[model samples]
Target: MCREPYPGRVTAPVFVLTPETVEPAGAAATAVAGDRLVLTGPEAHHAVAVRRLHPGERVDLVDGAGLRLVCEVTETAADGGRRERLAVRVVERVEEPQAGLQLVLVQALAKGGRDEQAVETATEVGADLVVPWMADRCVSVWRGVKAARGRQRWGAAAREAAKQARRARIPEVAELLTTAELAGWVRRVNDAGGLVLVLHEEATVPIGGVALPDTASSEAIDHPADEPRGGGKGPQDPVTIAVVVGPEGGISAAEVGALEQAGARTVRLGPHVLRTASAGPVALAVLAQRVGLWG
Candidate 1:
């Protein structure tokens, strides 16, 4: 299906698109908004032919860059028998408020596609960015062409998962990174006043006890950004928390030491150890709730 959740029971089915699909005044958002949009290509065909959605029905469209259009379907027909047409009349254009803190998942490469699974679940849980890590204990290796293909697959997975969750902002899928590179990311996030956490079975600190950005108010972040990646940094230095999860064999003591020296705090998710594919998502869910982004 091309559509997914819309918060409440009566909300329209939501679809995600790239910003390039709708540019200029066509996708231009405004406070008092009413516009016309045609959703063609796969999105239109899936809705029209597959789901059997029709005109006069309500739907929601998002560019995945923060613009969401609550619309009423107007047309569905064969365009010269060459294409399927699904049109909508905009009811309102709403921009979802950016989360005060950005969530990042740094998942280690694991065999049997478990790394991919980790990233997919993390995106659905509200991760703003996903990083594929080449850890010391990783069983899977992404070398040369494999690295490019791996990253591309991760990006596609994150997009599909985000759309399924009906998120307006799709989480970024970064290139496969080595432990040294992961350390650089830690420095970057910390410079921007965010915390980097490593989930270890041996850590003394618990996940819930970690420091978090204020959810009570939009208090400005005190940290200054030395290098800003996306919308996560500003005056608030927007907390860019990164949850690091190791591979099936688990993180090595040496790798743990390296990360801790680079500003990452070793933290435990629970008493029992989780699978490599399960650890990052579990930590992300816990942190999102601690920061009050979830109930």
Candidate 2:
């Protein structure tokens, strides 16, 4: 039996809408108050046709952009025995504080279906960003239509996983990057006042021992030409850390060289080897906890 309290019956169906759809001036004029935010979409279909949700029920809705709402259904539409519109009254709307640490996982594409698992776990564990790295050892080749499909699949998985974990924020999945492009990204992030940490099985230092780069030091660092003009300050200053995880066969010597050249610090996670799919999230969990984002 589960020891945790049951969240209670969901009265309103929760759905994710584009930022434009959730804006006050947009399609649905649902008011926000406390912890409740209200909106309706295909998620309504899932609630009615799938879950058979009815009026007076409650459900949690998130914009996947760090907004969460708890709402109660006030009205439901029936069209030829099929559910259509769902109107809900917002009971509460709460904005979660940003995680102290912004961890971006630059994961090397892996063979098989491991890449999807990596993205799903990364989102659930609180990664702020996910970047697909096309490393030298990557066995998975994403091109043309496959690339488009992969991006869609990854984004959908992240959204679904975020809801499952009850997270207010959903991480962004960046377009795929080649080794050279990834190095440039590392440089750009570092120049933008973020610290980049590359996970290497052969590294001697434990990840826990790694401290966020001091704000003062980050400000003193030079910014790359393409980096944003502002030095680390406010939300941007406190050590933006990127965790780079290699593929199943691991990062190549050249790839490691490129990262190091881009000023990424190599850190080890643990004694044993973790699968390509697990390393990124496990590292993220540790970082999130150290930074007080997780208990």
lDDT of each: 0.74, 0.70
Worst 10 residues of 1 by lDDT: 1-10
Cα lDDT of model 1 by residue, 1-295, tens digit: 0112345623467676544444333454452356777777666666677767888898778766656787888887665453666778878776665555678999898898888898889988889788889998777899999999999989878877877777767777777889998887787777666788999888888988877744455432333223344334356545577889988888888888888888889998999989988889989889877776665
lDDT string for model 2 (77-120, tens) is 55635435556667776544443346688888887879889999
Model 1 lDDT vs. the true structure?
Answer: 0.74
Model 2 alpha-carbon drift over 4 Å, by segment: 1-14, 19-30, 33-40, 77-83, 96-100, 214-238
Tell me how candidate 2 scores on lDDT: 0.70
Question: Weakest 10 consecutive residues, lDDT, candidate 2?
Answer: 1-10
- Tell me the deviation in Å of residue 282 in model 1: 1.2
How many residue pairs collide in each prediction? 1, 15
Question: Which candidate should be chosen as best, given TM-score against the real structure?
Answer: 1
TM-score of each: 0.85, 0.80
